[model samples]
Target: MAYGQGLADRVRTLAPDRVTTATDLFGTETAETALALGVPPERISTIAAGPNPPGGVRGTGGEQARPADLERITDAILAGEITVPIAATFPIEQIREAVTLQAGRHVHGKIVVTL
Candidate 1:
């Protein structure tokens, strides 16, 4: 999963079997990058926004997370089927540090800012 081109490039270098991008700016460039990385066209999925949308792309206003979905995910995490890495944690007073780390775009996991 990649949020932007920079991360996408990094992911591509790893030659993943599939690439999923949650970027509103997904376009030809992103697709090309994936292709160059040897990811099959059908294996690349992207999320885009707008009324017209891109050709051959279906638009879903986006899915809302139901309580059951959240519960299932939580259960998976608790069962060790899913793992969420925490890159760093900061107290609320150090929110700036957390934000800075997040903005650096090099984080491989979630950054938690605690209350």
Candidate 2:
């Protein structure tokens, strides 16, 4: 799934043989764009039944309707099957530093704050 207008086209171009399905998680607005890029209507899908709100997939409702990619990651997190690297850890009092650290270029993973 892609949020941008031309992104699906670019992805299709990257792997024309591999990608058979596409989802416009943002809803019908991009469906035409996907179609224009040669994806069939039957291969396109929306996570929810209606128009999606402003924030795209994140704005869509709960886990039940979320795309498979999100579900996989969530399951992995819950199962402790993956680890999110911690770039730095700070106490709650250092929230500012935490934000600054997150904004920095060298921080590759999450900056965690502890209570």
Candidate 3:
């Protein structure tokens, strides 16, 4: 709750009721931290495993995670119920425009610039 001199960085989880926002995995070298935070590996059982690489959840924004939240999203994505739409693709020269569009919330999903 307080950001002082020596506090470890923390993130806000989508489900604060049952999620952790730290970058450490429950079973990795960060085990002690996870234990201190009360997030165990067993709580990560049903995650709708992805072909994507691990540590993919780390974000530019500090967002927290609960396994259930991940499963819910993965299920919807896999089921074609919810999709990440590529709203627009532009050329390299158009990168600035694309960013402006995104900043203004005019673009949805991912905005990409190609060669």
Per lDDT, the best of the predicted structures is 2
What is the clash tally of candidate 2? 0
Name the candidate that leads on TM-score. Answer: 1
Error of 2 at 95 (Å): 1.0
The C-alpha lDDT values of all candidates are: 0.61, 0.62, 0.50
- Candidate 2, residues 1-115, lDDT tens digits: the string is 3345576667677778755545444345555555566666676666543754222322234554557877897898889976577779999999999988777745656788999
Q: How many backbone clashes does candidate 3 have?
A: 2
Q: Residue by residue across 38-74, what tens digits does model 1's lDDT show? A: 5555554455534543333334433754768878978
Once fitted onto the true fold, the runs of candidate 2 whose alpha carbons sit more than 4 angstroms away are 1-75
Cα lDDT of model 2 overall?
Answer: 0.62
Alpha-carbon shift of residue 51 in model 2 (angstroms) = 15
Question: Candidate 3 lDDT (Cα, whole model)?
Answer: 0.50
* Model 2: how far residue 82 lies from native, Å: 2.5
* lDDT (10s digit) by residue, model 3, range 62-92: 1456668878888988999765678789899
Query: What does candidate 2 score on TM?
Result: 0.36
The full ranking of all candidates by TM-score, starting with the best, is 1, 2, 3
Worst 10 residues of 3 by lDDT: 53-62
